[model samples]
Target: MKTALALLVGSVMLAGAADAQEKTIRVSYETPPAHIKSRTIEFFKEELEKTSDGYFKVELYPSAQLLGPSEEVAATARGQIEMSAPYFSYIAPVEPLMNIYQAPLVFDSYEQLWKFLETDEAKALAARLESRNLMPTGYWFENPTRLWGKEPLRTLADVQGKKIRTVPSEILQKAVEAMGAQPTAIPGTELYLALQQGVADGAFTAPNYGLTMKYYEVTEAVTKLDLFLGGYLVLFNKRWYDALPEDRQQQLMDAVAASRAFNEENVQKDLAKVDDDLRAVGQQVIELTPEALAEFRDALAPLYGTLDPQIQAMIEQVRGL
Candidate 1:
């Protein structure tokens, strides 16, 4: 009986040691503290720890502390980090089809963008991540894209001969050039300095981003263009994810879904407050007339034809939904 008791105690001690050896995952994102993206990640970290009963822990590195926007996807893929939240445009170089999410005027509302993510085509795109040894656990919506400039951009002609900073997406670059602007690929972190120094005269970004990034301080005008909706992929290192127990895997997936919902709610709230915030900061907000809106959309139409066929098919499938 003493031998049996000793054996049982040894077993328990070994199990405890194994459990203690499970490492905490590190997740990275480029969003600053005031951004909803950072808030959503905080929510995930809290909920995941509670749900896992301390068996799983998440270490969040925000504001490019661990990896910059352009490097997040590659870092996650290489397992340098366990996970990252990267804007689709940043990952398009690895997954060119991701550029579809940046296609101007494709999604009229956040609801439509979420619906497309659950579609078959989106799932197929998610599958492509396996090749890079990465997994897209889910996606979060950023606010609708808006134009910020020193001068009013009421029509395509207004943008002619101007330098515009855009995320590194071929579609956006082509669209800006088509509108007669010199398109410059600039990282988000450097945009404010670029604008203030006259390296670029304008930028395309969400209202909340413009406000949080202090774009209003550099530019005098914010145009309500609503040209595109920004989407971010919450990716995980496949090897790390696959090694987790089945129950832990399910918990992570549930956490992702919950975090995404939280992010969506926050974005809606922030966007509602953007105009007032921009106005308070002395930025003029302009609404385009219907004719000007049509002209802006027409200028980007050629992009629809030039996008990858796979992306075009995905767009069609999403529209059908």
Candidate 2:
């Protein structure tokens, strides 16, 4: 009888081991196939597998293969996917304070943005992720925001009367309206068709995105407005992370930080390539003169008041830094 009991116990133990070994995690993104966002996800996959000795694996789904940007946060929270890299603005509806980073002209350089993100204000914002059952591992940089139009946009006056596609953010819509252009909020996927069909005239985006999305094919001019730093968040499902062993959690965090540094370095290099590619394609590239840039900045000043109080405070902290 004792021998029979031992056999049954051993069988249950083997089944438990098999269940643990079957664990799999999925990471998804909406960026185009060739974009840096895809590259970042690739890095995450490689590093996590290497560090965990193949015990932890990340399967990547790019170009909204699993869910669109609007649905990613909720899907992750519900454990439908293990992770997602979402644009800051798309997550703004869940955490309104996130729009602080989306504020026009708030960050003039990558260094400025990095410094602010390391502060208490940024930590406070990151803590909000816990309430939503998400963990913000780190951020990957998108190129500085700029304009793409069929015709050259040398100054704010040039954008007047043009119907521009923008994200459905109140601040961005207000900024576009204040600059004298009619704002049309559209999803990222629909942008190309909208521009080609004359449903919209032009839109604002990072140079790298333009290259990846083939915006240069439809738009002949690239304007360097550098109005806002496009930011993306790397998030993980809190439940999955919490279930991991302590050492495994540490390994994952270290890998993510290392990957983020690599991603930022690559972005700087790609920015130079984007400039060369735009010039090669016969797209007119225009840099705003100091006087004109200031004028454009002044026109969007009202956006500061439109931000949430927490976001306003975060901006003040960033400025003070």
Instruction: Give Cα-based local distance difference scores for all models.
Output: 0.86, 0.83
RMSD of each: 3.3, 2.4
Clashes per candidate, residues 3 or more apart or on different chains: 0, 0
By lDDT, who's the top model here?
A: 1
Model 1 misses residue 16 by how many Å?
8.4
> Residue 305, candidate 2: how far off, in angstroms?
1.8
The reply for model 2, stretches above 4 Å from the true place, is 1-22
lDDT of 1 by residue, 79-134 (tens): 89888888889888998988878888888778788888877778888889888989
| N/CA/C clash count, model 2 | 0
Instruction: Write one digit per residue (lDDT tens) for candidate 2, span 47-128.
Output: 8888889887678788888888888888888889978878888888888888887888888788999999888778888889
What is the alpha-carbon lDDT of model 1 when measured against the actual structure?
A: 0.86
